[model samples]
Target chain A: MTDRLPHPLRSDALDNRERILDAARALFATEGLNVPMREIARHAGVGPATLYRRFPTKQMLATEAFADEMRACHVLVEEGLAEPDPWRGFCLVIEKTCELHARSRGFTEAFMSTFPEAMDFAAERAYALRSIAELANRAKDAGHLRPDFVLDDLILMLMANRGIHTISKTARVAASRRFAALVIQAFRASPQHSPLPPVARLSPAAPGKVM
Target chain B: MTDRLPHPLRSDALDNRERILDAARALFATEGLNVPMREIARHAGVGPATLYRRFPTKQMLATEAFADEMRACHVLVEEGLAEPDPWRGFCLVIEKTCELHARSRGFTEAFMSTFPEAMDFAAERAYALRSIAELANRAKDAGHLRPDFVLDDLILMLMANRGIHTISKTARVAASRRFAALVIQAFRASPQHSPLPPVARLSPAAPGKVM
Candidate 1:
């Protein structure tokens, strides 16, 4: 009976935290990281005081909001490293990472931007890159990836993948899949001449026909 | 003497117009299409009244500023069509066009955005696409381009190209060149396994090392 007295209040606090994070992720994914804390609070149906009490700064909120995605990124790299075939592993990482970024503009911005103050985030990013570089070296040694493939090529491909804009999430993913396939083909050491994934309707001017 | 009386006024008007366009183009290229008319007037050393009298609206200013680029775009297509090898012509168009867009963000936004009121702009874009479609057809018929290539693939490539962000114009163009080479390889019907262009420094996190 004595412990039960505090249970409701603790659960309420947990609920508020979840709501705040949900709102933050949705807003950030859609509108980007520029969304104000007050707007986020409003969306989450919490007071500014409660929001600030929980997250003191925008960066803190962003880091917390993207924590899940950051973990997923790490997991992706780990999965790629686990694959026995280095080329297939490298391709898997690129395709999955591109799809992940394509689905969330805010995550892309956060990952790509240099956050000087966020040392942990920076470390995680470096670790991911180092792992990928190791994977790439293995692929190159196996004579699967092109000899000239550079780490910068992955960055270049990611930046290009980020440019994909579609009317719907499905369209974006579809477009990303095709783009990744093309990039993989480009990165191949030997020409397999595989048929590309079907084109996504990305033409801005005309809707009926692409040209 | 009566006819010559208005010569100074006409020349002054023409000079103001040129200054306005020069300012617009510079700002739009560097800062994008969101720079205000007042800021543009200030940059041009012209009064707001004069700027408005010259350009009427932001769209007019943009259209006028980008006229030379538009003409250059047309000339690039024409030059591509003049090439003896249809495959070479197609590659040339893609490479040059990607470079063009890489150099100017404003031009890309203007080109991609559907300005419902800008009928002439739409018509010009249509003409460009149709011409490229004709070029693609010739390339495919020559068995140079992959059979599965569709016109939307070009749009997809352009959109992907637009994702390129670099610290300098040179780096951006370099990155675009590498990207174009990769795309061209991906689009080839036969795997040439050609060497890729040199990598550009595009890593946002570590400047000294890519990975």
Candidate 2:
């Protein structure tokens, strides 16, 4: 069978497609992966049949959206790797992950869970995780991190950032910052087998006020 | 009206009631709270009429079993509070809670959702939490803990121990111990604001694994 590109869309048809995706992103932010298909069509000023014709199913649409996020994350990781300072690179991954996952409207569990092809997506996550691990190991070897520390531990902490959604936005940033600082200190002390920094002696950020 | 004690149970009636609970515990552990009452009576070696006499409805029977678990937790909290060491009291609360909740013989999502009365159990949990917080506060005042920390953060981390359950059992234990030591260091450092002791540093017990 000869493979052919999708027929070029009229300008109106192309605009409608972009509108549908924008609506889908909004609906997913509020209603998660289970939002009604009709709502997306209505928001996009298209009929239900048009949506079905274009995306075929929710999973296909979600798979495409998820792939976009993977691409965005890839850019950030590459940027982090390019940094001359390993610690800054590591910190960028920490800060950007918390910010994006916490503050954005684009990412959704619905897109993640509803896609039947999530295994392929999961493999991508695994690859991304290995890249982060590589960054941590480089930092450790450079003596910025503890030698006994494994990169997987940091990954677990990062993945657990999913729980950030449960907290308020203001608190989320503060908690992330505090947690990041603690992890960094933990990494520094690990190689020397030095004890954790005394919680009291460390400079207090502010009482009752979170960073 | 003044409350009065129930009439003394006949030996046979008491034996039959004990038998019923034992069978229910076994069934619920293996089959969940939805196990049929008829099956419960048959397994208990009791007639339908006798089972109904003791527990008129399935909810009543489930409440009894669920209440028993909650009451056991209540006692553990009380016992832990009576410990001489402040930190040990909180530690016992963590260990005991881990055992009971992890090994519970029932999953009562239905009861929790369907009945308002079922939600009253939070008071008991709050009481236990308050006791632990007091111990942490006392420990801090004694120069035994980190000064700036609050007990809720510790409780959250302790409660999140189950979150780490995805790893190996040995990993679970090591994480538990690592957190315990971390908490202790934090507790001691709170008032002193000094660095934690080297002995408080925990190495991953899981060899050849990174997480």
DockQ of all candidates, in order?
0.22, 0.06
TM-score of 2: 0.61
lDDT of 1 by residue, A1-211 (tens): 2124534557787789789999999988876676788999999999999999777877778888888899999999999999999999998998889888877877776776655354356677778889999999999999988777777777778778867643345566777877787788788876543332222222111111100
TM-score of 1: 0.83
DockQ value for model 2: 0.06
Backbone Cα, N, C clashes tallied per candidate: 0, 20
How large is the interface RMSD of each prediction? 14.6, 15.6
Residue range with the least summed lDDT across 10 consecutive positions in model 2 chain B:
B202-211
Instruction: Please provide TM-scores, in order, for all candidate models, with all chains considered together.
Output: 0.83, 0.61
State each model's CA lDDT, in order. 0.75, 0.54
Best by lDDT: 1
B1-211: candidate 1 lDDT, tens digit per residue? 2124544558888888788889999988866677788999999999999998876778878888888889889999999999989999998999899889988877876776556354346567777888889999999999988777777678778778877743356667777888888888788876543332222222111111100
RMSD of each: 9.9, 11.1
Clashing pairs in 1: none
Model 2 C-alpha lDDT per residue in residues A1-211, reported as the tens digit of each score: 2114777777887687778788886675544455688988998899998888778877666555556666777777877888887767876776666555544333524312223344355556566667777888788777765565555445434433433333344554555455444444445533224353222111111111100
